[model samples]
Target: MSAAGPRADVIDEHVAALSAALHGPARAKSRLIGEIRDGLMDTAAAHAADGVPRQRAARLAVREFGTVDDLVPSCQRELTIAQARHTARTVALTSPFLVACWYLAGSIDQGQAWQLPRTAQLVAVHLAGVATFAALFAAVALAATGTLARRLPTPRGLPLVVAWAGTTASGAMAGAALALVTAAALATDWPLLVCAGALAAASHAAVAASARACRHCARLPVT
Candidate 1:
């Protein structure tokens, strides 16, 4: 982003267009933009050193970089991978806490209130197990798109896989949390209930936000 010349201004506008056309995790997008800017500037500097006018060098650099439409599909691939990895990691990391919250909430009741009904507890436990399995499945997707990516043919629609797995895992976590909340309320474990409620809120919020970004990235047409 040089501010000194009309050609620099043109290149800046070009870069902005490229940025506008992309959507993904902010960090990944920012990193990609930074790399592009640095590259353009470096190329412009090289031309300037070779006796080209600085302004003209900037114009040449912009042209050499190709059009936004040409660059964005490649940039988007990277962003989509970053987004998918982030979502999978969040789901995997949150799974343990999701289970622990339920376990601790139920255990700390101490009989101060009515015991949770056995049937409901069993159902909640099974649902929590489902959530755990989904989280683990997300981890598998993570691996597929990561280290194993180089070793295996990248499956088409891998982003969709990550999105759905993360969504299912987070959705199941929310369901089980809601069920546990009901059981806690029935048992009247106020302190335990609040703790579990907070955990559920924070964990679901993180997973849901990442899953949403993942979903958008998955559905984003080969831009």
Candidate 2:
């Protein structure tokens, strides 16, 4: 019985030491998380006082954290649950537009209108030009998305709306470009139209799926 008692005491001492070590880290992380959350709230409040839209406020709040990639990793390290959740939500909302842009670019690249008449060739060339622009836009969006994923704040509400609206408009322009290219392609080989249309549709669908995932993630309660 005497031997067992000493063994039990030694185990208890070790457990206490381990717990103390864990507690220190936990408290530190909690403090850091609190700071980030408070900062975000303050930014929101300030933006509100300025009569800015909530989305813009959210975006500006995030911008204060620096770039998305830098912010995400920092938040992750601190285990800032609220900050992480908000950043994730922003990314979710914007992913569809990024995906759509990429899809449009690819469609333009593969469209068959370039093989047709002089007018059709000109239209195809224009479509290609538009694709090049979309590629650049996609690159930017990808960087932004990656940054946001890592824990950066993205613009919310009005700014988010404006950004997405701009993206949608760009998509519309891409569609128009596609139509011009399609028309020219049909003047040559009608079969390519099906492939081009499929590519566009598939890309749009992919974006929608990505957007859905982001929305779903946003709705999840933070632990």
- Tens-digit lDDT string for candidate 1 (33-131): 999988998898898889988888888998899998889888888889888889888989887777876586557545453555333455556766866
**Winning model by TM-score:** 1
| Model 2 regions lying over 4 Å from their true place | 1-128, 145-186, 208-223
lDDT of 2: 0.43
Evaluate candidate 2 by giving its C-alpha RMSD to the native, one decimal.
17.2
Q: Rate the local accuracy (lDDT) of all candidates.
A: 0.77, 0.43
Q: Write the per-residue lDDT of candidate 2 for residues 119-185, one digit (tens) a residue.
A: 4334434544454444445445545444654787443332233234334434543463465445535
Q: Which candidate is the best by lDDT?
A: 1
In candidate 1, how many Å is residue 108 off?
5.9
Model 2 poorest ten-residue lDDT run: 16-25
Pairs of residues at least 3 apart in sequence or in different chains that clash in candidate 2: 55-156, 55-157, 59-155, 68-147, 69-147, 72-150, 72-151
TM-score of each: 0.87, 0.31
